[model samples]
Target: MTFRECQRCGTCCEKGGPALHEADLGLLEHIPMSDVVCLRRGEMAFDPRTQSLQPLSAELMKIRGKDRGWECIYFLSQAKTCSIYSHRPLECRSLFCADTAAVLEAMAVPTLSRQDMVPQESALWDCITDHENNFPVGQALRLAKAETDFAGSICSELDDLIRREIHFRQVLADRVQAADRDLWAYLGRPLWLVLLPLNPIFSRYEHA
Candidate 1:
């Protein structure tokens, strides 16, 4: 199946649940935190139990106990669409059904595998790798040079850059959180438990 062949039944959209990334927060600047609602509390922050990070809140928690697992406030069942579609989140944009997956993979964009990613810690490594590779080399060099002569102005810009970088880091963290959960389920084992026993064996093999 391919993307072109997709019937756009929106089945995946209806059944599919994708969380937001840090970079996606920029889109929420116009949206007040008061109006936004969190779907899953666990989805909004780093879950130590699952070792995953949650998405950001568009609006602060208004109704008590309203924000908990799976269902999102932004999801509108009537329209059969996300209320915040433009700013929806990396997970939402990247999610695909079988047909979409085949199309994306053919285009050379990496597609998620149920085996590769878990719902909790989805695509974190890829996010980190992308951020690392996407850093602006020219801008960094210019900032470094400008700091020496125009410390005050450059400092302000540097602060903004730092914030942006931090946002990107958050995106990576979110991905890790999702992937970690997925991996745990996939391996059918806790990460620590599996790695502790396997590390030494793999190390020995590497040396050989």
Candidate 2:
């Protein structure tokens, strides 16, 4: 098989910005929060074991990118360059879709330790903390629980917590923008998405 060399075509960026790695924490303050988003515990993730996108049991901070289209936020479609190319995440630099070995090896690299993050003394950060703590990834079975039962009136407590987080992210999103806003964007999605609970993370590292 002839291996194709990368041509900087931005197709990978369409898969979304690289997940934040431990090495990429340094770029946090340099990049606008408008360009980042956190993946909470309850959100679905692919379980290599099950070959399914199951909800994880912990929080993960990642760069915000296009939802349905898979475009990285920093990717400039017009010019075909990353707006933050010089400081792109480690995965962004190491990933080479055409190179199977490289792609497999890169998968083992861990994302930025949430422990490395120094929470700012602000309401937004507090809100984020609240969201993670309130609707924790306490049960992997949450993925299997009928949504109507897990996060519905049957679980009004969780439902209310989810609503608060939605409002929190929406209100905070308006505050952070590309206009030199220092914090990461707090773009919350639908309420149902917010209510899924996660199991504990596989790692031993303490999170912020």
Candidate 3:
């Protein structure tokens, strides 16, 4: 089928929300921070353009999905239309499933980060920075990919780290008075959830 325009089929929105770009900064006035999520750098996320998982080159702040699923929060499932159609992010406006050139080009552009969303002088920013340093995702990835478990120590250590991280996230949320819906955006997804992409390997280690 030859496609020339968007049919508002909800295919794109159903897949996932778009990452915000510099041009979409102004749209933040209407979009709540709770509706966004920060994919930390070095984290493995599904790249729609490549249709596979890849480590992010930089931090990416994107809209959170609905009910913890990939469907865009703004998508009205029954109507198959975007609630914020008029003020959608740049990536949303550039999407054309039939001719993805525009969307692919848009993906190449730099994305907005959590740092950009919070004021540098704010105390919450300090917490964010401290959290990033205390639980560097890159370090966790290295440990997970290490050549040997050595008496299952690596897995043991990782299990502990995961537990500590969970506690830390809760503490941070309390300190910032952030709701559960907003915690993912404020601190990134849980370490265990992020490690899910490693699959049977991580699972094996967990059980070992």
Candidate 1 local lDDT, 22-131, one digit each (tens): 43455446433333322311123333224565442221122111222234445666666666777665555655554345324332333232222224355534443354
User: Would you list the clashing residue pairs of candidate 2?
Assistant: 14-70, 21-112, 22-112, 33-183, 33-184, 33-185, 45-54, 137-198, 137-199, 138-198
Write model 2 residue lDDT over 1-208, tens digit each, in one string.
5567777777877767767767777788787655676565566654433657776565566776664233787898877888888888777777777765664455566765344564567665576567556545443235335445432233545445445545654555566542212233443333343332332221111110
lDDT of each: 0.38, 0.56, 0.80
Could you list the CA RMSD of all candidates, in the order they appear? 19.3, 8.0, 3.6
Cα-based lDDT at residue 53, candidate 3: 91
Residues forming the 10-long window of minimal summed lDDT in candidate 3: 199-208
Candidate 1 error regions (>4 Å): 1-17, 30-69, 99-208
Check candidate 3 and list the clashing pairs.
none
Which predicted model would earn the best TM-score?
3
